[model samples]
Target: MPDTLASNPEPAETRSRASELMALHRAEKLLTVVNVWDVISARVVADVPGTAALATASHSIASSYGYDDGEQIPVDLMLEAVSRIVRATGLPVTADLEAGYGDPGETVRRAIGLGVVGCNLEDQLKPLPEAVRAVEQVVKVAEEEGVDFVLNARTDAFARGRERDPEVNLADAIERGRAFLDAGAPVVFVPGKLTDEQVQALVDAFGPQRLTLIAIPGTPPLARLEELGVARVSFGPLSQNVALTALQELVEGVQRGEGVPSSMRVLN
Candidate 1:
């Protein structure tokens, strides 16, 4: 687990206000949501004046814990990551709490205590109803906490490695999306195999007033998303992977007795 934020001097009022700022980020036009794993990356992202908010990538957190992404890391590790990022920057932070760490209400209660303004909860590992229940529980917690905590509920039916029919998955996702929205999720994230037509279909089906559509990596660009009526776009774990790739290349170059490029070195 990372260091605790209790060591810092930030007050409860400030944390609550930061949560509100994070909630407004969801209503903005074309916000850039970069995923960070630790304090350094979180601080770097916060320094970007235009960055609306920060998101935690579960894969990065898992890797930092010397484990894999799929339920290998403990909930404590995830909460610690959020706490570190929140302390590292004043920017509103949204954590990717994968599957809400099992229990719905307990997860939300824990997350609120950590000072996170928003979170991404997915329906990949659990059934649709279970996911809905989890989202609803989180939303209720957000309401009671007096924070505009944006709950981004993700649907992974398309990403799941199965021979299920696309129509069935789409119907299931749509139903889950509606339930999540009714349960207080402001955004519904669809993560895989989404075409322009399908994106349009979802937007039309859900309606703009009901829920915002969020696309992950492999989806079209920002322009295409706007054209397709997508409200938000996130890269998930791609940014962390990009940083890792750069580090790997730099290390290989050094081992080969080649000096690293000036652009690649951070000379602070």
Candidate 2:
């Protein structure tokens, strides 16, 4: 049977949400995303006053379901969790689709079907031509689906090249990021524990509001990023780690016979 999803018209609201997400990346202020894992986290973050959109962390979602990161969770299972989150709120969602579940175009088609208007598609250090072709495929799929999908194409040069010289990693990231942009990716995601000079170099290469980053321990401050014209900053799985840390502390306290803290708000 032919797929009805591919033939049907996309919802107007989904198109609008996609546009909104794209604008957030181009805004002067850095778009900060505290990545969510499930419906509860989605709702909690969506209710925040300034949260313009939500992003999913693949690592966090997989861990929540007892699966490892890197597409360890079944693609169908991941889609269901993402669908529940999409239904939980009206905010636009950009998912972390790690390596595109081994089929970049098909995975994005499924995500678009579930109301995901944007995604982070990692290169995983694939050959340069292969990675750029993946970005092109994602762009083509989004165009076919009739949505202005935000493709945050990620290059793992810095993440995977920590053992190499800093200059070597910087050049590689620039080369890959430029190719990804030329292939129609809206922004390039360069994730790692970056130094201030490294961030500036990337900004210089990609120009203002074209680079996205992950927030790690040594990353530059948000204000500094804004001054350098970064498009977005997201705390990947660390946000989930923070939440889990609190949960662990509460459980330990209760084990010592303490009651629930009086300051908790019933968000859910």
Candidate 3:
């Protein structure tokens, strides 16, 4: 006999919530995601008002376990981390399934089983054609499983410094974005600091509602970003970096015979 879940579609409530989660990016306001790598961070972010969704940062998650990013961590271990994050929140959860780990279809199946309703599948080191093919397979599996998952296809040309000329990089990103979108990805994510002109060009070419970019220190503010018509804005590993940097400061201070600062104190 077929497994009940495999045969039967997701419950209406689950499906409705999934749809609502996907709709947040299409709204006028920017959908800001503070990427988390653990249950504690997941709980903290989910409790904040106006958080549309939560996504796991694969780099941070790998770092937490003493592994570098780029699929260094095993897929099972990564999905276990994702499961903990999902258990911490009722809101939609998206996992950064970096390059789909190994097999995108299998990775997505495991992600869906863990209650994830969305994912960021990056191009990573895969060539443009290969990335598009992977995206197509992931979408196919998600639809077959009746998950209706939000597949956010990530392009890493700019972030990885693939091309010498910035124009060449931008052109490649746009081309990949089109292919991914055509392959059934709901959004295309380009992570890196892009100039205002470059950002505008991506938005205009890709359609603002389907373009998602990582937020950086000097990028335009949220209000300005919304005006620019971006679908989503996310901090890939910035949150973890900020938190760790503060703790590192405290550790150094303690080593220097100085007590923790008042601002750093934890109340009982």
Candidate 4:
């Protein structure tokens, strides 16, 4: 038998919110997730009338601290950002807890303590077996905590192999994804801009309700993903890129002696 995480299940209110976020993945309409970096983006997204929930993008959040992704920033700072965002809204917030901070047990405890109901646990640049073990630890603690936490298992084969070789074998993705799920991951997020066929293959291998896709330009539109039966779609760092690109353009215009766009100019 598994050890109890929490003597009692989550409070009624926390359980209700967690269940609703979990249901979004099983709903008829595709769950479109907008990944936020900080409180500003989080609040803006949370205020959207049609938004379902908020997720954090580690890349964006890390960059906000002048660091590259992949745990470049300290775990303390990262969780602090998560805490602020988690506190800013009534909706469920899941964080991109990169690589479980190298300790799945403590990671689970800290995440729950911060009021997060879900999180993405990546493979942490380790072999499949190691990642599976980490996932097991996380799942064990989560169940004991009785928070109904949702773990989105992320496979980094595409990213891990990009520097050495751009080729990402679908077989590797399948093997890792299945291993994680069998270890108790509720969702498998296959990142990168895979083809419609590759995306479909993932969904077929891991049921629509269990597969999560990271959206990119090459991928089909949001509606098409729904038609193809994906469970969740995330715009990881894309929103941040868009926001930064606009600011870059504004700076360039200023450098060119062009006045600020009237739309953004403050009128005293």
Compared with the true structure, what per-residue lDDT tens digits does model 1 show for residues 58-160? 8888998898987678888778777878777766777888887777567767776777777778788477677777888888888777767777888776667
**Ranking 1 against 3 by lDDT, winner:** 3
Pull out the clashing pairs in model 1.
none
How would you encode candidate 4's per-residue C-alpha lDDT over 117-225 as one tens digit per residue? 8889888558878989988998898888777778998887765666544335577788899998899888988887777787788888888788888888888888888
Model 3, span 36-110: residue lDDT tens = 998778877877788878989999999999999889999999998888787667778889999887799899988
| Candidate 2 Cα misplacement greater than 4 A, ranges | 1-10
Better of 2 and 3 by lDDT: 2
Error of 2 at 17 (Å): 0.4
* Regions more than 4 Å wrong, model 3: 1-14, 264-268
Give the per-residue lDDT of model 2 (tens digit) for 1-268.
1111122224787898899999999888899999999888888888889999999999999999999988999999998888777777778889999889888999999999888999999998999999998999999999998999999999999989989998999999999999999999999999998888999999999989999999989789999999999999999999999999889989999999998889778884
lDDT of 4: 0.82
- Selected candidate, larger TM-score, 2 vs 3: 2
Q: Going through the candidates in order, what is the number of backbone clashes in each?
A: 0, 0, 0, 3
State which candidate has the highest lDDT: 2
What candidate 1 gets wrong by more than 4 Å, as runs, is 1-28, 209-218, 265-268
Candidate 2 TM-score versus the reference: 0.94
Worst 10 residues of 2 by lDDT: 1-10
lDDT of 1 at 177: 80
The root-mean-square deviation over C-alpha atoms between each candidate and the true structure, in angstroms, is 3.3, 4.6, 5.0, 6.3
